[model samples]
Target: MKLWLGTGLVEEDVAGVSPLDRGFTLGDGLFETLRVKGGRVLRLDAHLARLAAGARVLGLPLPAFDFAGALRATAQANTLAEGVLRLTLTRGTGPRGVLPPAHPAPTLVITAAPLAPPAPPARLSVAEGTRRNDRSPLARVKSLNYLDNILARQEAAGRGTDDAVLLNTRDRVAETSIANLFAVLGGELVTPPVSDGVLPGVMRAAVLAEGARERSITPAELATASEIFLTSALGLRSVRSLRGRELPGFSVAEHLRTRIDGA
Candidate 1:
C-alpha cells in the first residue's frame, strides 16, 4: 500500500515518524476516516470541517496543504477507486514534558486501502462498567485517545458480540463503540443528542439532515425501539439484537440505507 506522509506519497513500509512525535507519545492528534467511491471522497468538506473544528479546540495549528487534492492523489497513487482514506494530523516532535512547544510543526499522514465488503447486521450489548462523560470536552472531539473505546469493544468481543453500546454518566444511551446509534420509536427516527457524549459522526449528520431527530435516549427507550441501526462513514448498518434480545425488523434501517446510498 502507498501513503502520503507530509508532502509526498511513499510506500507504507518506508513511512516513519520521530520517537518524540506528540501524536505517538501522548495521543495529541486528530484523524478522519473518509470513504472513497469511484475516486471521489464522500463528504470531503464535512470531514475537513470537523478536523478544523478539532484543531481549533485542541489549539493545534492546521497544517498547510490541499486536503482534498492530497486525498485524491493518495487514492490515485494506490489505485483505489473505492476504499477508506485515513488522514491523521499530529503536533510534530516535541521535547519531554506535557507543555507543547512554542513553535509546533504538525505532521500530516494520509493512507488509503480497499474496503472490505460490508458485514452482517451487528449484534450489540451494553458495556458492563463503562460510561461516557457527557460534559467532557474530549467527548466531542475525535482525538487519538481511544483506549476507552478499545477496551469497551474488547469487552463486547469477549461476550461474542459484534459491538457494545455505551451510556452516558447519567445512563442515557450515548452510542456504540465506533458508530453513532439511531432508533425508530413511535414511527419517528430518533438518536441520542451529541450532548449525550456521542461523537457527531458525518454519516450521523447526514441522517439528521434527512430528518432524524435528536433526543435523549435511555436504555429503556432503546429496549422499546421498533428498529435500531448504527451509522458511520462506511454506511448504515442494522442492529440485529441488543443485549441478547432480538430487535424489530430492519425495514426502517434498510430504507435509510437506500436514501443514503442514493444521496
Candidate 2:
C-alpha cells in the first residue's frame, strides 16, 4: 500500500516518524477523516476548514502544501475508488516539556483504506467512568488526545455494546464515543450543541442542515427518545438499542440517509 508522508508520497514501509514528535509523545495534533466515493472526495472543503480551525486552536501552523491534492493522490495510488482517507497533522519534534517550541515543523501524513462493510444497527451504553469536559476548548477540536473516547469505547465493549454515550460534566447528553448523537424527542430531531461538549462533526453539520435542531439534552430526555442515530464522516447509523431497551424507529435515520446520499 502507498501513503503520503511529509514532502511526497512514499512506500508505507519506508515511512517513519520521529520518536520526539509531539503528536506521539504528548498528543499535540489534529486529524481529519474523509470519505471518498466514486473516486471523488466527499465534503473536501468542509474537512479542510475544520482542520484549519483546529490548527488555530492549537496554535499549530499548517505547512505549505497542497493537502487536497495529496488526499486525492493517496487515494488514487491505493486504487481506492470508494474508501476512507485520514489526514493527520502534528507539531513535529519538540524538546522535553509541555511548552512547544517557538518554531516547529509540522508532520503531515495521509493514508487511505477500503471502506468497511456497513455495520449493523448500534447498541449503546452510557459511559459511567468519564465525563466530557464542556468547558474545555479541546472539546471542539479534533485533537490527538483520544484516551477519553478510547476508555468509553472499552467500557461499552465490556458491556457487550457497539458504542458509549458520553454525558457532559453537567450530565447533559453530549455524543457517542465516535459519532454525533441525534434523537427524535417528541417528534423533533435534536442533537446537542457544540457548547454541550459536542465535536461539531462534519456529518453532524450536514444533518443539522437537514433541519435537526441543536439543543441541550438530558439523560432522562435521551432515554425517552423515539428514535436515535449516530453521524460521523463514515455516514449515518441507526441505534438498535440503548441500555438493552430496544428502540423501535429508524425512519428518521433512513430518510436523512436517502436525502444526504442523493445530495
Candidate 3:
C-alpha cells in the first residue's frame, strides 16, 4: 500500500520514521482517524479543526502542506471508496531529554485502509484497572499516549467483554475505550461533557448537534439507561449490554445512524 509521507506519497515499505522520533519514543504526537465514503473524506473541516486544536494544545507547529489534498491523495492512491484514513503528526526526532528540540521538524504520515465490517452490538464492562485523567490537558487531545485506554481495553478483554467504559478520576462516566458514550436516561439523549475527560469526538459533536445533551453521568444512572450507544469516527453502535445487564433497545442509535448517514 502507498501512504502519504510529509509532502508526497511513498510505498509503505520504503516510508520511514526515525526511531528517535518523539512520537514513537515519548508518545508526543496527535492523530486523526477519518472515514472515507464514496471516495470522499467525511467531516474534513471538523477533523482539520480538531487537529489544529490539538496542535495548539501541544504547542507543535503543523506542517505547511495541503492537508486535504494529502488525505485525498492517500485514499485515491489506495483506490479506497469505503475505508478509513489515519493522519499522524509528530514532533520528529529530539534530544535526549523530555524537553523537545527548538526548531523541530514535524513528521506527517497519512495512511488508508479498508473499513472493517460493521461491529457487533457491543458488550461493555466498567474498567477496574485505570481511570481517565480528566484534569490532564491531554485528556481532551487525541494524542498518542493511550496506555490508560489500552489497559482498560485489556481489562475488558480479560472480563470477556468487547470494550470497557473508563471512568474519570472523580469516578464519573467518561467514555468507552474507543468511543464516546451516550445513553437514553430519563428519555433524554445524553453524553458526558468534555470536561469529564471525554475526547470531544467528531461524531459525538454531530450527535450533540442533533440535540443530544451533555452532562455528568454516574454509574448508577448508567445502569438505569433504557438504551445505550457508542459514537466514533466510523459511526454509531448500539450497546447490547453493559456490565452484564441487557440493554436491548437500538431505536435511538438506528435513528441517529440514519440521520448521520443521510448527512
Candidate 4:
C-alpha cells in the first residue's frame, strides 16, 4: 500500500486511507507508461500532452503539474537505465457516490523498473482487436481501466503472436497493443490518421514529424505502399516482415531500418 500522494512520498500509514478507495474500487484514475532512455524520456512533451488530453476525457481536474520537474525527479528515482517509467494520477479517496467530489485531490505515483530492449523484430503478428466505438470516451484517455487491452493482449498471446494490431470498427488499422503502426506504399510512409480511432502516440508523432520534415511521408499516398512498420517508445521502429500470407517487406524497409537503427 505504498503510495506517492501529492508532492511527498509516503507509506500507507502516513498517507492514511481506506481499502475502499475509488481508484482501487472503480479504476477511477489515469496513467502513462513511458520508456526512459539516456537520462531522458522519449518525446516527453507529447506524453504530457496526451496526459492532459486524457484528463480532459475523464472530466478530471488534472494536477497543476511541473512537467519538466517530474521528469527530472522520475529520472533520478529511476536512474539512467533502459526501463519503464509509469505515472499514475488517481482522483483521491472519495465518498460512496457516482457524482465526483467537488474538491478532489489527485493521488500521484511514479513507478520505474529496469529494462532491456528487445531483439530486432523479425516479424509483427496481427490478431483481432476489440472493436472500440468512436464514441467511447475512454478510447481517448489512458485510464486505469484497461480491461479492453488486457483481453486483447490475452487473445493475442493465444494466437501465437508477439503483438496485436487493433483495428477500428471501420476495419481500418488503429494501432498495436502498445505502439503505433506505419506503412509504406509507393515509397511514402503512411499511418492511420488520429481521427481514425487511434491514440496519438508520442513516438509515433515524433517519427511522423521527422518523416514529414525529411519528405518521407506524403499525405494520402500510403494506401499504395510497399511495406508496413510499427514504432513505440520501447520498440522505436520495426517493419512488418509479413502480413497474413503475404510477404510485405520491401527494399525500402531495409533502408528505413538503417535510418532508424542509426538513430
Candidate 5:
C-alpha cells in the first residue's frame, strides 16, 4: 500500500516512526477518517476542522502541510476512487518521560484504501458494565486512547453481536463502539446529546443540522424505540436488532442516507 509520510507518498510494507513518538508510546494523537466518492473527498473542511479542534484540546502542534492536497494525492497514488482515507497526526518524538517537549514537532500520516462491500445490518447488545465518563473532556474528542471502545466491541463479539451500545455514567445512551446512535421514538427522530459523552461525529452533526433532535435516551427508552440506526464516516447503516430484539424499520436511516448523498 502507498502511504503519505510527511515528505511524499511511499510504497512501503511498513510505515516507520520514532520509537519515542508520543503517539506510539502514549497514544497522544488524533485521527480523522474521510470518505472518498468518485475521486473526491466528501466534507473535507469539516474533517480538518475537527482535527484542528482535537489538536488544540491535546495541546499538540498541528503539522505544517496541505492536508486536502495530500489526501487527494494519496488517493490518486493508490487509485482509490471510492474508498476511505485515514489521516493520523501525532505529537512527535519526545524524551523518555510523560512531560511533553516545549517545542515539539508533529507527525502526519495519510493512507488510502478501497472500502469493502457493506456488511449485513448490525446486531447490537448493551455493553456489559461499561460506561463513558460523561464529564471527561476525552469523551468529546477522537483521541488515540480507544481501549474502552475496543474492549466494548470485544464484549459484543463474545456475545455474537456486531457491536455494543455504550452508555454514559448517568445511564444515558452514549453511542455504539464506533458510531453515533439515532432512534425513532414516538414518531420523532432523536439522538443522544454530545454532552452525554457521545463523540460529536461528523455525520451526527449533519443529521442534526438536517433536523434530528437531541435528547437524553436511556436503555429503557431505547427498548421502546421503533427504529434505530448508526452513522459514521463510512455512512449510515440500519440496526437489525438490539439485544436479540428485532427493530421494526429503517425508513429514517434510508432518508438520511439519501439526504447526505444529495448534499
Candidate 6:
C-alpha cells in the first residue's frame, strides 16, 4: 500500500520502524479516518481540528507539519477514484519501561485506498460488549487504543450483524462501535448527551445544531418517522433497520439530511 509519511510519498515498508515502537507496544497513539469525494476530502477541517484536539490531550507536539499537504501529496502519489483516507499519529519509539520518555517527537502517517459506498439501510446488532464509562481522561479524544471497538465489532460480525450499538456502564445508550448515537422521541429532538460518553462526531455536531435551528430535529413531530440514519465519513450517512427492530423514520431528519447535502 502506498502511504504519505510526512510530506513525502513512500511504499508502506520503505519507512521501517523498530519493534519497540511505543504504538505497537503500548497503544500510545491516535488515528482519524476521512472520506474523500468529488475531488475533495469532505470535512477535512473538522478532521484536522479533532486531530489537533487529540494531540493536545495526549501532550503531543504538532512540530510544524502541514498534513493537508501530505494528504494531497498522497492523493497525487497513487491513482484512486474515491477512497478511505487514514491519518495516524504515534508517540514514536521508546524504551522497555512504562514511564514515558522525557521528550519524544511524534510519528505521523497518512494512507489511502479505494473503497465503495457502504450498504444502505444498514442493520446493526445491539453489542454485548460494554462501553466503559467516561473514566479515561482521553474519553473525548480519539486515541490509537481501539481494542475495545475492535472486539465489539468482531462480536457483532460473529453474530452476522452489520454493526454494533454500545451501551455505557450506566446502561445509557452511548454510541455505535464506531459512530455516535441519537434517538428521536415525542417530537423533541433527543440523542444520548455527549456527557454520556459519546464521541463528538463532526456530523452529529452539525446535525444537532442545524436540526434544532431549523426545527428539523423534534422527535415529537414524527410519531411515524419516514427515515432513520447514522453518519460517518465512509458512509456519509446510512439509514438503519436496527438488529431486526425497525426504527421509526423521521421525515424531518431525512429532509434535513437532503438539505445538508444541497447546502
Clashes within 3 Å, all models in order: 0, 0, 0, 6, 0, 9
- The true-versus-predicted C-alpha distance at residue 74 of model 6, in Å, is 1.1
Better-scoring candidate (lDDT), 3 or 5: 3
Model 4 weakest 10-residue run by lDDT: 212-221
Candidate 5 lDDT by residue in tens digits, 44-139:
898899999988988987867799999999999998889999998988899988988999988888988898788778999999757888999889
lDDT of each: 0.91, 0.95, 0.94, 0.64, 0.90, 0.68
Write down the lDDT that model 4 would get: 0.64
Give TM per candidate.
0.98, 0.99, 0.99, 0.80, 0.97, 0.85
Write down the lDDT that model 6 would get.
0.68
Stronger candidate by TM-score (2 vs 6): 2
The true-structure Cα RMSD of candidate 4 reads 4.5
Q: Rate residue 249 of model 6 by lDDT.
A: 60
Task: Give one digit per residue, the lDDT tens place, for model 4 in 1-263.
Answer: 23345675455456654465667878888887777767667666777888889888777888787855765576665464566677788888889987778888877776566766565653544546475444566766778987766766776778766666666666666666766777765556667776666666666666676573222233223334566666665545554444333445655445654554224
List model 1 lDDT by residue over 1-263, tens digit each. 89999998999998999989999999999999999987789999999999999999899999777999999999999988889999999999999999999889999999998988998999999997688889998888899998889888999999999999999999999999899999998899999998999998999999998899999999988988888999998888999999888986999888888888425
Best-to-worst lDDT order: 2, 3, 1, 5, 6, 4
Those runs of model 6 whose alpha carbons end farther than 4 Å from true positions after fitting are: 212-227, 250-253, 261-263
Better of 1 and 3 by lDDT: 3
**How would you encode candidate 3's per-residue C-alpha lDDT over 112-142 as one tens digit per residue?**
9999999999999999989999999999999
Q: Write the per-residue lDDT of candidate 2 for residues 240-263, one digit (tens) a residue.
A: 999999999899999999988524
Give the poorly placed runs of model 5, Cα more than 4 Å off: none
Clashing pairs in 2: none
Better of 1 and 5 by lDDT: 1
